[model samples]
Target: MTKVYLALAHQRQRWMNDLFQRGYKKKLKEEDLFELEERNTSSKLCDEFETNWKLVVKNAKQTGKRPSLLKAIQKTFGVRWCLYGLLALVKTIRLSQKSLTTTTTGEIINLGATDVLRFDFLPQYSQYILIGPIVSIVFVFLLWQVVGVSSLAGFLVIIIGFIGYSLTGPCFGKLRNKTALRTDKRVRMMNEIVSAMRVVKMYAWEKPYASLIEKMRSSEIDKLLQSSYFRALSISSSYVANKVTIFAVFVVYVSLGGRLVSSQVFAALTWINLMRFPTATIFGWGVEYLSESIVSIRRIETFLLLDEKEASILDDIKINTKRNSASIVFENFTAAWDDVNLAYVAENRDATQRKTLENINLQVNDKKLLAVIGPTGSGKSSFLNAILSELPAKTGGVKVRGRIAYVGQIPWVYSGSIKDNILFGEEYKPERFRAVVKACALTKDIQSLQEGEETLVGERGVTLSGGQKARVNLARAAYRENIDIVLLDDPLSAVDSNVANHLFHECVCRYMKNKVNAFYESFIMYG
Candidate 1:
């Protein structure tokens, strides 16, 4: 633990000095480049790894060997090669998801529940399952035709086939439900842990919470094991069916020669082709690692390849005065998350998927204070996000002018020092930086620490209190001096009323002291 903390502390110090001297290698707001993200989570990452991560994700149109039909056939021919294939599949899925988020933001809406529930039919999974049975029947029927089997014998074969088919369905159905439910559960559980880490800390219930989550993770492993068992069973069942049919054909040929013109081995070969569809249909259909990765590939591919809306806003407008800020305009416009009238956007059609915000227009003047008020989920955050350029506005709908800085609610704090959170890989302006620290009432918070500004905050700034996190976020927004606009998304919502009042006063006094640019303004969307 000491070594871990020391290593983390050293990393923070290096980044602190680095940001001061060099800053981030690239700007985040730049439209042309994807921001570099260098972190990985172990729990939810693909277990079925793939070496060809870049190949699968980079150009989905050109399907390569990783987790494709071609590769699957190769692996089937030589199962030893499958170990390499499975490893490659994992990396492929992870990288694909990362690329998609990098390229697309607005358009990747969830599929309709009904459509998603038919996941079994998706080509990645369904083609194998459906083809296996169809091929099996076709092979058997063709063999029967060639041999000229009697009506009674053919009827008996069909009855046996039907009985054999019935045994597999119930197990396959359970596997399907288990695969889906478990994956969904893992995703949701992860969200809860990260988003609500504050609650766990405040309650001092980390151990219990972690234990419970680990238990859930263990359950997922168990589910996967169960799926593997059933898949093996499925393969075994196919062999059993083939052996029975082969034995029957041989006995008939031996007892009554000349009744069978071709050897039974030839017929077995036909039956082998027929088995393809069912083997693919039942077990491989639902919960195989390969099938899961394929499902991920589609979502990740669309995300990586989806066209991003070009940055059309004018960033070089000439200033009428030497002002740092500008006003914003929202024309007569309406926004809905889901429009019942929208035929093409058929998904999220449920009325229960309530509208985030309706048609309303408001103007925020330069160097002015505006408070947007509404209950939680009443589009308050939506309104703020629209102005901040995080949410998309219709062409000609949002006409925002001037430079802007933002402080988000529940703002992100990295796994570093309190000061690093404020710096955020930016070139430090010593005077302005110190001013921001004071403005946000963080000087005292820093003094309480052992190493002051250098104090390591650990992951998500877990070492700091909630109110302290808010302060660091506030300082980040307040760091710039010649700012045109500052948008605070409930900056003081977490602090005491008195502290909030003091912080707001400090912010105003600092702004008023500076030569106010015609564009300079501060806004409290949820003030």
Candidate 2:
């Protein structure tokens, strides 16, 4: 009885393997085959595999060429049956899809929301460029061919409309992008505020912070508006040029009798005269498009050419601030950047000097969370920046000390959830996270809000209070687990003293004491 059972199992496995082999051949033929005369036979008793043909090919090798079985089956049963198979498959899929629709969780949208906002293709697609004009001219010609000379009238109108569109697209995009970039530049200044906490709290410098941010934002707006004005002027210029061409065409059309000339020779002349207006209008539109493109491309080029982070790579600036010193050291250290400095012109301001720091000698050894305080003209922020290697002493630089977490002088947040603002993708440490929150004393403040961590901070955290915003930033920096050395540049110039003192002592100062306990056995690690 055991031998019989083993034999039956082995036989079933062999039959399944054969069926799978046949199905994979891409054959449309039905797999349910048998001698109808032998009704009571053992092989005729099988039921499962005798259904659809496609299921047999389930485990087939994925390949470029169709399998042999499919071809043979198609030849025998014919290709007409293949259509039915595909139709059935599609119907089955649709039915299955409809049935599962409610339970389905994931879907993909083309040109994702995040991408459309971030990427800039205006310069490439802007009609202000030469390609834009040339293409428009060709398009006019083809349109004329399709709709006859009467189409030129609409084409002229369209050209006019395109001119308006071309003018606005680049200018708008540029202003928006500039505003965004300026906001970033402003936020990066937060170092100045963080390092100046003691005096800031003593003086209650909310007004100063508010004023500074307002100025920066104003500067960005002014720049955007100015760029937009230029774009508008460019477009208007193109519009004028096009009108000139249109006027010229009207002059010719009126002088030539303003009617279609059917004669081959005269018709050619009519075509020329009709297109005269269009050509000029197209030229004008092209100008507008190209101008915008040039400005956008030029702006994009400057940033892209900078020896900065490429958009494709996700590497971070590895900051080392282990020593909050008034001095820095570089022993037998080499920072190399070949021919990158000569790209920029300094003009009359040391006109030939393009490099900022190279093989630079500097010191800052006041390691007590030393204040990098200096007059506005003095390179106070620059000094701290140099220590962290954020500025890079002429690129590929080495400092060989400390772990640093940077908080800029300017207070700026993002159009993200509050949790995103505070955590910033760092590993979640509940106790440490709470400690930072409590240290910054934003615990009760945020919890009282309805959304708590899920709160959607509008653009630049527009909805947050200055203190709340600063605390959020502190929370972000505090979460960097390995950060021992804290290098702040006036980050707290906007915060109150109580929160500043607590955060300074416990998170930064007391970390020296707590770091030893890290090696103990009971430190419950999260992941």
Please report the candidate that would top TM-score against the real structure: 1
Minimum summed lDDT over a 10-residue window in model 1 is located at 106-115
The TM-scores of all predictions, comma-separated, are 0.55, 0.40
lDDT comparing candidate 2 with the true structure: 0.49
lDDT of 1 by residue, 137-231 (tens): 56556666555452224335534654554454455456545554555555566667667877778899888877877887787678778867866
Give stretches of model 1 more than 4 Å off: 1-178, 190-233, 258-325, 336-359, 373-379, 389-396, 480-483, 512-527
**Model 1, CA-based lDDT:** 0.54
Could you give candidate 2's per-residue lDDT for residues 1-527 as a string of tens digits?
Answer: 99999999998788677667777886736544433455333343222212222232322325422223333234333433222221111111222211222211110111122112222333223223444445556655754563355446535654665566555556655565565456555654454566565568889996888799789878977987786686666556555644554454444455656653345324444444454433444444444444443443333322222333221211222333333332335443333222232113233234244443445553334344344445553555655545544344433333434455666667668889877787887877778777777766777887988998788888767678887887787667766776544555565667667666665566555543322111101111212
**C-alpha displacement of 193 in model 2, angstroms?**
21
TM-score of 2: 0.40
Q: What is the C-alpha lDDT of each candidate?
A: 0.54, 0.49
